[model samples]
Target: MQDCHILITRPEPENTLSCERIVTHGWTAVPLPMLDIAPIEDAQQRAAIRSQIFDIDTFQYVIFVSKNAARLAADWLDTCWPMLPVGVHWIGIGQGTTQALLEAGIPAISNPGHTTEALLEWLKPAKMKDQKILIIRGLGGRPELGDKLEERGAKVHYLSLYERKKPHYTAQTFFMLPDIHLIWVTSGEGLHHLSEYATQHKPEWKTLPILTPSSRVNQQAKEMGWIHASCADGADDNSLIKATEFHIGKQHD
Candidate 1:
C-alpha cells in the first residue's frame, strides 16, 4: 500500500478522520469531497426547532445518528442545555459518533456498533417501550430505524441538523483520477452524488477501486460501473482500515 493514493468521498471536516487513517497506511490521501453538510434553512423547520428548544428534557434518550449529528447536537446543546443534563441517555450510532460526543464532554453515552441495525438490536423493544427518544440526524437518511423504534412503542422525534450537498469542482475532477489508487465511500448518498458528477462530466473516473462502508453502497458502486469495489464488514474506522488493507494486500499478492 505504500505510495497508494486514496480518495475520500465524505464531506470536508468530517472527512479528516478517513484521510488520517489512509495516510497511516503510507498512502497519499486525496480529498475529493463528494458531499458537503449544510444546515437546513427552511423557515418552518427552523421555527419548529426554536419552539421545541425547551422540550429537549422531555425525551428520555437522544440519539446522535452520525458524527455530524453529534457536532450539531453539541452546538444546539450549547445554547439550550448549556450544562450537561442528568438522567437523559445519549446514544451514538457508531464509534466515530461516540468519540465525537466524548470530545464534546458528554459523559453518558452508548454505542452498540456502527450501523442502524446494530443500534436497533441494542435497543430491545422491551426496554424501549413507551420511552421518548429524539434522533438527531442530517437532512436525508433511512427511516427504518425511526419506524422500527416507533413500532416498538417508543415515541421518536427527528431533529435534522444539516443537509449533504455536492461540491462545485473548479478543475475537471476526472483528470485527478490517475493518481488515485483507492476511494472510500462513506455513505450511499455520497457515492450517488459522485456518480452523478462523473456522469455529467467525467465518465472515465468510474474505473477506480472503491471501498464502501455498507453493502447497499457497494451495490450502488457496482451498478455505477466501478471496476473494483469492497465493503467494510462494519462502519467503524478499524473495520474500514481492515477492509482497505485486505484489498490492497490481495492486489499485491
Candidate 2:
C-alpha cells in the first residue's frame, strides 16, 4: 500500500481530510479534484433557498444529496430555523452527509446508504403517498432520486444551494497522473470529468483501478472504457481506503 498512490477526486477542504486519512494508512493520496463547488451567487437563487427553509416544516422529508448539500443547506437553516422545524424528517444520502447533519444539530437523521438508489430502497417500504420531500443538492445533477420519489406517490421539490463545475487543471497537475495507481471518484460528475480529461490528456492512466461509492459510477466508468473500475461499500473515506488496500493486496497476490 505504501507504494500505491490513490487519486482523490473530491473537491478541496474535503480532499485535504481524505489525504490525511490515506496517509495514515501508508498510501499516498493525490488531490485531483475534477469538480469544484461554489455557493450560488445569484440573489434570486439565494432568496429561493431561504424561502424553502422558511417553509421547511411544510415538507415531511428534507433529503440532502451529499455532504456539500448538507453543509451548505445547514448554513441557511441555522439562520431560518434556530429552533429546528417540527415533524420534518432529515435524510442524509450517505455517512458523510449524515455526519454533517448531526454536526449541524439535526437529530435523528435517517441515512440509508451512500447512493440515491439505496435511499429509494429504504423509502420503498414507507407510506410516502402524498408526502412532500425536499431534496437539497447542487445546481445540476441526475433527476433519478426525485423521479423515483415522485413515482412512489410523493411530491418532490428541490433546493439547489451550490453549483458544481469542472476544475481547471494546470500542466503541473498532469505530472501526478503517472503515479496514480488507483482513482477515487466520489460522484458521477467527477467520474465523467476525470474520464474526459484523462481521455484527452492522460489516456494511459485510465487503465488504473478506479474505486467509486456507487454501482452507477462503476457502470459509467466501465462504459467509458475504465475496465478496472470497482465499487466500494460506501462513499466515506474509510470505505475508499479499504477498497484501495484490498485492490493493492490483490495485485500482490
Candidate 3:
C-alpha cells in the first residue's frame, strides 16, 4: 500500500512531535501549523503578566489550561521567584499541560482526563467556596472554566500568558497537497482555520476524510460540511495514528 499523506494541523513543537510519531507508521506526515503560540511581548503586558505570576500565592489554586500556558507561565515565574509559592496549588488540565509543568520545575496535579469539564469534575472534592482560583491560558479562549467556577462561588481570575495566532495561509494552501489522503485536526478552532485557508481555492471539502481528536471537534467538522470526519478520542499521536489506520483500511475494504 502507498504511504498515506496526512496533514497535521497543530502548532510547532507539538506539530513536530505528532509528525514524528505518524511517520513511524510509514505514513507521510505533512506539517501544516495552524496556530502560532507565543508569549505576550508587549512591555506593559509583560509587566502585568510578571505581576500576576509573582502574586500567584494570593490564589488558592492555579490552573494551567494548556502546555503553552504552563510553559509561558513558568517562564515568567523563572524571572522573579527563587522558590515557588508554597501554598498555591498548581494544577494542569491535561497530560501535556501536566508534563509541561513538571518539565518547568513546577509540581502540578492532573486528573485522568483532559478538558476543562474534566478538571472541574476532578476538583469537586476540593472546596473552593470562598477561595480565589487562577487560570492561565492564551489570550481569547473560552470562558467556560472561569464561569463554571464562578457559579460554584469561587472568585476566578485569568492570567493571559500568551497568544495563539492562526498562521496566514493562502487559499492555494490546500492545492499544494495534490496527493493528500487525510487531514487530522485537534481542535475546532484549527478546523475553522484550515477551512478558511481552503475557502477561496477549494470551495467544497465534503468528500475528504477528516480525523478529529475528539467527538466535539468531529461534530464541529460535520456541522461545517465535512461528511467523513472520524473521532480519534484524543490528540496524542497514538490515538490519531490508530484512527487513521482504521479509517484508511475501512475505506479500502
Best by lDDT: 2
Per-model root-mean-square deviation over C-alphas? 2.1, 1.4, 2.0
Error of 3 at 188 (Å): 2.0
For each candidate, the alpha-carbon lDDT, in order, equals 0.80, 0.86, 0.83
Candidate ranking (TM-score, best to worst): 2, 3, 1
- Which residue pairs overlap in candidate 2's backbone? none
- Model 1 lDDT tens row, 155-205: 999888788777888456566555667777888888888888867766666
Candidate 2 versus the native: TM-score?
0.95
Per-residue CA lDDT of candidate 3, range 165-199, in tens? 88977757666865677888887788888877756
What shift in Å separates residue 175 of candidate 1 from its native position after superposition? 2.4
Clashing pairs in 3: none
Per-prediction TM-score to the true structure, in the order listed: 0.90, 0.95, 0.91
TM-score of 1: 0.90
Alpha carbon deviation, residue 167, candidate 3 (Å): 1.2
lDDT of 1 at 192: 86
- Single out the weakest 10-residue window by summed lDDT for candidate 1: 170-179
Q: Between the candidate structures 1 and 2, which one is better when assessed by lDDT?
A: 2
